[model samples]
Target: MTQQTLIRAAVVALLVPTFALTACSKSNQDQAQNAQAQLQQANKNLEQAQQNLAEAKQQAAEAKAAQEKQAAQKKVTEAEKDKAEAKQKQSEAKQASEQKTRQARSEARNQAKSESKPVCSDCGTISSITPIQRNAQHGSGVGAVAGGVAGGAIGSQIGHGAGKTIAEIAGALGGAYAGNVAEKHIRKVTVYRINVAMDAGGTRTVTLNSADGISTGTRVRVEGNNLAPLH
Candidate 1:
């Protein structure tokens, strides 16, 4: 063949080998770059997931703490109510006991007053009243002597000698006895006898010249030998 054609063929053959080698090296570099980009994206997504998990844990812990605080507050309120109720019951019991004690004291005092005894020593109740009469004076012998002398003189004037003497003696004796009886009747005293039962224990009798205001069932007081109204 010709010399120029032969040289051209040689150049073509060398250029084609150089171009294929360059293209293959470029494709390998591109594949490595794409793999590195995928790895970086996966690392970013993992970090975001970890942050979200930590936030959720923190919110759960806060909610638990709030519940615990509310429970503690409710227990404290119940305790305060129980204390107030106990104090009120104790106060009512003490008041009732004091009232009962006061009532017992009042009853005791009333019983003592009802059982007391009497105080007067000279007081008495009049049980009986009786009217009586007594002679104020005894007969004197002077009246008897005067009446005998007058009766003897009168008898002597009526009769003679021995008969006059016997009549005079009989008249004198009768006149003396009559004069004594008249003297006793003229001097008489009226009185009242009162019988009393004493409070201290015995009975006594009192004589009064007059029964003006005293009667049976009357209260009286003894003074020396007399009695007075006790009202």
Candidate 2:
């Protein structure tokens, strides 16, 4: 070929190769940028997922805590019920025991009176008289009065300001009922211990339901183990 033609052909060849290389480079750069964008998007998704997982864990923990608190409250309520039931059972048992004791005492007293002689009848000079205030007693209507006083005193210290009034009323009601129950079901009796000196010889002790119509130096009648003052 001619030199000019050869030179033109060579120039064309160089230009075509340069253009192909530039196109390939641009395509590779675009692919790389796309890959970077995809990577950024994946990282963002991962961060979001992580946050969601953290929130789920927090919710789970809060739910567990709440369940535990409810369970604890339920246990407390059950415990209180059990305590109340136990107290009721105890009170019942005490009442039964007292009844049994009373029956046995009555039977014993009857047997003793039948067998034992009425020694030193109407014998005895009352040496001393003592008056005792009985509180834990049955059959007197004293329980309600005592209970009201006690409950009021205790309730007055329970709350402050306006709430104290409400507390006092509630306490008084509860205490009154409790006191009545205790008196009827718990306390067997209360009495005075009387001692007597017999002119016939021998000192005797007796129990009286009340101190009325009897005092020191008072004349009394002795029947078996019992004693009564003269009218």
**Each model's Cα RMSD:** 16.9, 35.4
Judged by whole-model lDDT over C-alpha atoms, candidate 2 comes out at 0.82
Best-fitting candidate, scored by TM-score:
2
**Model 2 over residues 123-156: C-alpha lDDT tens digits?**
7788765555455544456777778778877888
**Model 1 stretches with alpha carbons more than 4 Å out:** 1-28, 110-231
- Least lDDT summed over 10 consecutive residues: which range in candidate 2? 130-139
- lDDT score, candidate 1: 0.84
Query: How do the residues 103-153 of candidate 1 rate in per-residue lDDT, one tens digit apiece?
Result: 999999888867877556888999998989887566777657766776787
Instruction: For model 1, give the 10-residue run with minimal summed lDDT.
Output: 136-145
Q: Rate the local accuracy (lDDT) of all candidates.
A: 0.84, 0.82
How high is each candidate's TM-score? 0.38, 0.48
Report the alpha-carbon TM-score of model 2 versus the true structure: 0.48
